[model samples]
Target: MTLRIALRPAPLLLRFILPRPSLLLHQLPTRRAGHGPGQRVIHYMGHQAGATQPPTPHKTIHFCSQCAGPVDLKFVSSEDRWRHICSACSHVHYLNPRNVVGCIVEHEDQVLLCRRGIQPQLGKWTVPAGYMELQESTAEGAARETLEEAGAAVEIVAPYVHFDIPGIGQAYLLFRARLAPPFTFAAQAPESLETRLFPLEDIPWDELAFSAVSLALRYYVEDRRSQSWRMHHGVIRKQAGAGPNDPGSFKLTDYMGLPLGAERIQTQA
Candidate 1:
């Protein structure tokens, strides 16, 4: 917790080239904790929140995004990986990780959280966050999501965490933001049912919408307790091997060495 730093916008693709052992990840023990009535806990992360993985998407792919032509999954251009290629137009559709931007809006000792009104975790609580839009910076997208979901304005502070869930094919960018005076919010977005602020102890850890949300809150609370904060970059992958505590089960690696505010980082090693 001694480290304290921030990051500037960099191309997300650069992450793949970084050494695997350098990315430190915090693992969440598989749990069967209470999730209310009629809900069965899933083993892997990224199964929830409509964050499905590639090659085998959550939604069936019948047509290509580039062209309306019928698409088929097949090896393309001597590439080992199978891709969604258009049958008529031969346009290959490359599926990449989606970027989700959001903020941890802090006002004094309280942090804002919202109750989701949508699936796949309807009624669960989370910090205001959602998919990033085209042409919008991560910070701007975070601010926009805060206003849209919680109906609260926030001043972007600094990058807090960059979580990669390869199982879901998504990356989350969370910023530490400040809420303006009055600290009022409404559940304006259709995705949110309600919004409220909670002390660190009172946060609903078990009812969080995603594991990343819980992880972020835990990190924030820990940082406050130690009076130190640093930007976090990590990944969440499916449990591997059989042993409960095996290194292969949950690998925690250090983050890539991309400087905080670089204009463009090399993607190739």
Candidate 2:
């Protein structure tokens, strides 16, 4: 007797040319994970790089910022997840994912990339990006990071990709940008060892610093090749049993064209 496993067809890519923000929010299912008892994991219908693992908190909070009091992890009933609650002042310290803003600095047919001088993935190439600073818009932060790391002033074109790495509590907001007037750049030290432009076909895929960078570059190349630009949303997750030193993979969960009349914001120098 012979036995075979039945496989289902992949889900169709849901595209919305000019979807309303409210409609998009309502249509997309929320992906959430919990660390409490009997946690449930939600996965979107998309291409999976490998086996998926439940989301984990990026870091543990030990003390409350409000009163400098010790905090304990407790499951909040309203939020339906665990949070660090202060035992002294009763202030709840909510841990939310951080926003990492960056830009894909484009000029002519080449894109700018920076080699890292820091410890994490040192010497690997990546787009200029870092944690968002306080009192700045996402676009402004992206541009600021580009200048700091790549020493290039860029004009924000449009929002490009929003990729969430829930396991590390980071949401990368990458934008498509072009070099401002003068079109000059250099590698800033400490943060970057070298900065250079690479044609789309010449991108150093094997030496990319992070999964987020690799995914963003791949999507950019795909859009350019097809001459159809779109905003992308997705997640980069680590495979089961993958260690911290392992290079993980990413999943493209959704993509959509910008809504009509979308306005471009100028990057603050």
Candidate 3:
């Protein structure tokens, strides 16, 4: 042939060959053992910004984050939305939602959970998760907390559930992960009294620390059975006549029906 020069592949094809930067940062596990590509993906359900109940003054609001002056909850704006505003300095102390990261670490057919030894829900069972720290991705925070609480290494699979708890101004990001080899169990975490793996049939549904934890576990079990998993994201609203700190009132009426064996944890005074 007179002209038989080979042409390079197009840039778009090269782009398709490259891995996603964000996906690489998650540190996905080598073995995608659980389900299909659908199950291994993160599907955004949706988002909602429900109004939070008026937060109680935890203590004497004697100072502000901005000026350290005396502050109190009042209508800082003409819109009638109450906020913590400084009376002395007129600085607004905008309260923000606290982000908590946790994971459902699966090994074979079992899931790892931790028993809390601290307040809020002391002695109750929960997936290993806690307040997210600064300068870390959600997956990193979840892995760190899982290691600290369950003493196990995990590779995050995908974001499993997102909870918008306006009642306490808490946003929970729960991920699905795989337990690394040599799965270790240690109650070394100060906040955790014990850590253990539970089969789907033996999960302590009645003793789960939070409603979202129970919901996530149930979803995990059901998804594995159907092999048609998808992300779950929704808002949980406080029940009428319930305070911001009251866990008994939080329910997912707008999401899937109430989780199995649901009961309110008696709020400690």
User: Which candidate's TM-score is highest?
Assistant: 2
Q: Order of all candidates by TM-score, from best down to worst?
A: 2, 1, 3
Give the 10-residue window scoring lowest on summed lDDT in candidate 1.
260-269
Per-prediction TM-score: 0.69, 0.73, 0.69
The predicted structure with the larger lDDT, 2 or 3, is 2
Candidate 2 per-residue C-alpha lDDT over 77-103 given as tens digits, one digit per residue, 9 for 90 to 100: 454456778989989887689999999
Off by over 4 Å in 3: 1-60, 240-249, 253-269
Clashing pairs in 3: none
Lowest summed lDDT window (length 10), candidate 3: 260-269
TM-score of 1: 0.69
Global lDDT of each model?
0.68, 0.72, 0.66
Pairs of residues at least 3 apart in sequence or in different chains that clash in candidate 1: 8-260, 22-253, 22-254, 23-253, 23-254, 24-253, 24-254
